[model samples]
Target: MNGLRKGSLVTVGTGIQLINHITHEAVQSIRNAQKVVHVVNDYPTQRYIQSLNPDTESLNHLYGPGKPRSETYRQMVDVIMGHVRSGLNVCAVFYGHPGVFVNPSHAAIEMARNEGYEARMLPGISAEDCLFADLGLDPGSNGCQSFEATDFLVHHGGFDPTCSLILWQVGIIGVGDYIADGRPSGHIGILVEVLREHYGSDHEVVVYEASPFPYPIAGPMVQRTTVGRLSEATMTTMTTLYVPPLATKADRDMLGRLGLGAPQRS
Candidate 1:
């Protein structure tokens, strides 16, 4: 028993694009694991994962029409844990960063650690990374704040309009169950109403979706629309809303306290 190999778990991300953005470390983890369980969006990526490991299994079948996503996530965690308990090294792969907006990955890792199993997560490119490159916007230029669309509306306070605001899952805002069509069934009208108070009707916003395919195959969807017209914009399960910051003057008092003059802007 003492000489037997112990169970371990490693979670990785396949990034937004199919196969193009997978990291070397993530690839190694997938290739070396005894079992590879994944939840990738595209068929090509699913095939790619299978190529890397013959023992690959998909958790996508857990999702069903009208099923609560919370239950699906719970089931996914249980499947991953089952592999670990059998003394097999398991690799769990998710689309985009495994740690970003992935409920099952975090839950599985936490549960594994709690059960005295070795578990860790590797970093991968997220949708936000692709957004910055495709949109040519720098988060450093203005501070960035990110939140789920529903959470932002429910706990709408202390969020600065002067900084770049990103609201994820705008299409599925209030929807808790899985749907086949992945439509914007959520209350998008409520989101538009709330944003109108902060940035006004004419303020431009982007309805963006990072392409799951490689470059030349497809490019990201970037729909620039005003706050007033957001309700009419195209939104899907993959859509993320990008709200540019409102222009504001610098704080003269803080500059004075720092003994600095006005900084030049580009």
Candidate 2:
């Protein structure tokens, strides 16, 4: 048992853009790994990764119609760990931040650690990061709340409407399995209903998709629409829902407790 220790694992994110968003540490991991398994969107990015390491392979074929994405993710973890257990320095790369809603990367890292192998995840630019930049939002000012679109629909309670809200994976509600043709998401109307309880039907919301390219080259696409019209809006796989803050009065009681006297409101 003592002699069985072998291999190492590192998970990295290439981010949303081509080469602009990837971290230097992530590129080094890809360059030095004995094996690399990745799932990226375009052929140009794929070729770049292959150029970094000839051992690079893609896990895109694992997805199919009628196959649960959870199953595919589990298979990805298994494949990544398989290489790690075989005395190879394995790199698993995903499109966005490796730990942000990336189940397989987290799972593989946990599995590798449990098996007594070294494993870690490197940070990369996520859509949420781009969202703040493109929208000119300072989350520090008003605070922010984030959740998956489906989970927010069913389980969100006590959520403050005065703070900014970010709903991820808005185009894939009620979708548990992979769909090959990439059809429009079906349950958006229900999502609108849930949000309407907090924000009125006329409350403006942004249906946003951060562009894969950097700003000005091809900027982030932002569509400002009311909550009522969100159901009618066209959504793709990358769409995210941003619900801006509503008006709220400041709590004078809390302000006094903090020893800060009431200042003039801006």
Best by TM-score: 1
Report clash pairs, candidate 1. Answer: none
Local distance difference test, per candidate? 0.92, 0.88
Model 2 gets an lDDT of 0.88
Poorest lDDT segment (10 consecutive residues) of candidate 1 = 1-10
Q: Residue-wise lDDT of candidate 1 within 30-93, one digit each (tens)? A: 9999999999978999999999999999999999999999999999999999999999999999
Reference-based TM-score of each model = 0.95, 0.95
Model 2 scores worst on lDDT over the 10 consecutive residues at: 257-266
Q: Residue 23 lDDT in model 2?
A: 94
The true-versus-predicted C-alpha distance at residue 145 of model 2, in Å, is 1.2
Question: What clash count goes with each model?
Answer: 0, 0
Best lDDT goes to which candidate? 1
Error of 2 at 61 (Å): 0.7
